[model samples]
Target: LDIAFIVEGSDNVGEENFNIVKKFLERVITGMNVGQEDIHVTVMQYSETVTLEYSFREIQSKESIIEKVRSIPYQGGKATNTGNALNYISKHTFTLVNGGRQDVPHLVYMVSSSPSTDVITRPPRSINVIPIGITPNANIQELRRISQPNNPIILHSYSTLIEEAPELVLQSCCSRKLWTEIPELCNKPMDVMFLLDGSSNIGASEFEEMKNFVRAFIESAEISNTSIHVSVLQYARENNLEISWNVPQETEKLVEMVHSIQQREQGPTRLGRAIDFVVQNAMSESHGGRPSASKVAIVIVSGRSEDTVEAAALSARMNRVSLFPIGVGNRYDEEQLRTLTGPSAANRIMKLQNFEDLSTMITLNSEFIKKVCMDPVRECIDEDGNKKKPGDKWTLPDQCHTVTCFPGDYTVLESHQINCERMPKPVCHSNLPAVKIEETCGCRWMCPC
Candidate 1:
């Protein structure tokens, strides 16, 4: 990776604070691998003018780089021209002559205490803004505009810079993919159990579809002993453990096992018994349940349970086991599913028209399920600064965009575009005119005769 630090050297950040900034850079650089073949770093100080302290080609070893940063004198000026600094680095710093490679990823860190006096434009490379000491005067919106999306680091005072150096180093070492992708996509340990309904009410074909749904979910997840440990159980009159979490299996092998699972279409659906069995036998330490891992159960139901489920569901929740119940067909009682999910039924339960709909529903809602498994706390802060739970949907004001908060660290924003060409033209009488009215979905024509 190639990194550039654009330090603010204006009068606002006095000589004492400037020394602290240098210390911050030294600590961050020390944490990273600094060699000719590895990370290359460039340092520039900007006030009314931008001055290159060093380029990537000037320093190679970690010790030499630390010494150079310590020896460099502060360039103090009256005005903070951040735009000039960004433009200078984009033109001169990241070039072949300066030891910048085409294959290496480029990152720019802008440390500033005052807003730019000139117009700030987005640079070609990825930029992260670090605003320190002057939060009230810092142009947060403009800083965000110039930096990468959601990539601004704010510090109340320069004294806090040393404390945050470790996290800054960690962020610097991350690959470009990790920075661009959703934060929750980062792996977390989870123990997931698929509790299948294999009663007589569901046909053999429907049971196969259920298996396919489970297989699809497993295929998409990062399955390993340290990541997501999966187990499957088929329940009817009796419970059959198809796959045990205790047995360590690769993802491909697990998928094959799920494919070979035959339907146990025996007596009536006794889902309550299955729930109780999982809580007692499946989620125990002896059964391969990790104490640190989040426990999740995806229960697929075909019809109403022959036994009561409310008490069993309550027990599961009390043990910190999250239950997501997918109700298939109209035969199952909606109220029972709601009771099974307890207070958060609206978000936890999914009702499908038939077994065939499972594929489509899984494709669309897989992220939602993954979020549930990864984020045990089950809350996210949206762009509007509003607290939202998983499955909550809201429309953006004055725009045709809808935002949904999934369980993880990200929120999905969907645009509802109007297909004006598909709509037929409205007819108007000779004496009256037609008026166009704007609606959330599209435009509508109103005529008065």
Candidate 2:
């Protein structure tokens, strides 16, 4: 694994907090294998100016790497130039000459205490960036912009990072399997409903684009009765069941229905009524909603609704369904969208500038489903087939031999000594009388003799 740490050194992070950041990095280093063959590390410091303090080639061992980290003086500056830092790392550090091998997995971990001065253009997909925000101050929007979809890791403070560093190192450094694998929707069972807006606000062309987006999303996933059962509902002042989960349609049939779907002409946007209809009629037991399976509702809207959405949204939440409201274009009410999605709305709500950019939602929605649907892999399962959570004192897998050495005491009381006797009582003619008395006591102990 080739990994880089781009630590924040903005002036807001004073000398004390700067040392705390370094200490956190050191803790993470202690948990990495960090040798020539495993887990090479590069450390960078970024503030108003970006500095590559050390390159991957300089990384020799974990102990030496941690020592170098401790020696870095705080490069406190006025602004947080995260954009330049991200760009620099992508262009310069992650290269063949810098000990970055194309065959191995590469990762960038950025720790920032403040928002970036400039907008962050995402780095290449090959180098996965996990932005760790030191919270209460870290800008989440900027963090999310830099990280992979649904993959930002936020810590409450530098103090809490010690607890998360081991897992961080394990996930980023030890295994490439998780990062390389593209998540498949059919792997987990889910009940999904796509509630789309078909109203006067959306033109015919825009509606067609929306359908294309839906088609892409649907075609990407495997759909069946056992996994990812899907339904589509189109609405304006009234609602239409375009694809019903109650009627069993295989993945092929589902895609075909979306292909031939038509838009409703000249109807007002009544999003609230549509949501209520789904909660009452579409997601019921008769409509193929299995309580055992995860229930997800995605509302795609292009404009403000004609009626209130709170009551209907609350009903969906009360029923334990996760609602994701996507606001397309600039005209929709931001507050309504946020309310419909609930708290952490920024994380759940997909706000797009135009309908043409709906392809971005595929990765975002896929990642969201992967995260909210299933629990992470567990080590053990009970007889009832329930997986057990990690117990206390359970050490994480040291796949790269992160903790190879142990501290112990050694006894070595029998110390050796080296001595040089006074040269044979130098017989100087001028000081013969003074030298003669000194020469008589010339004998010295090499080891107490």
Name the top lDDT candidate: 1
Per-residue alpha-carbon lDDT of candidate 2 for residues 48-128, written as tens digits (9 for 90 to 100): 878877788784698888888899999989988888898888788879887677788778888887988875778887887
Give the per-residue lDDT digits (tens) of candidate 1, residues 176-240. Answer: 33223233342777888999898888888788778867765665566776678889999999999
Go through the candidates in order and give each one's C-alpha lDDT: 0.73, 0.69
Clashing pairs in 1: none
TM-score for each model: 0.44, 0.49
Model 1 segments more than 4 A misplaced: 1-186, 377-449
Error of 1 at 308 (Å): 0.3
Question: How close to the true structure is residue 176 of candidate 1, measured as C-alpha lDDT?
Answer: 31
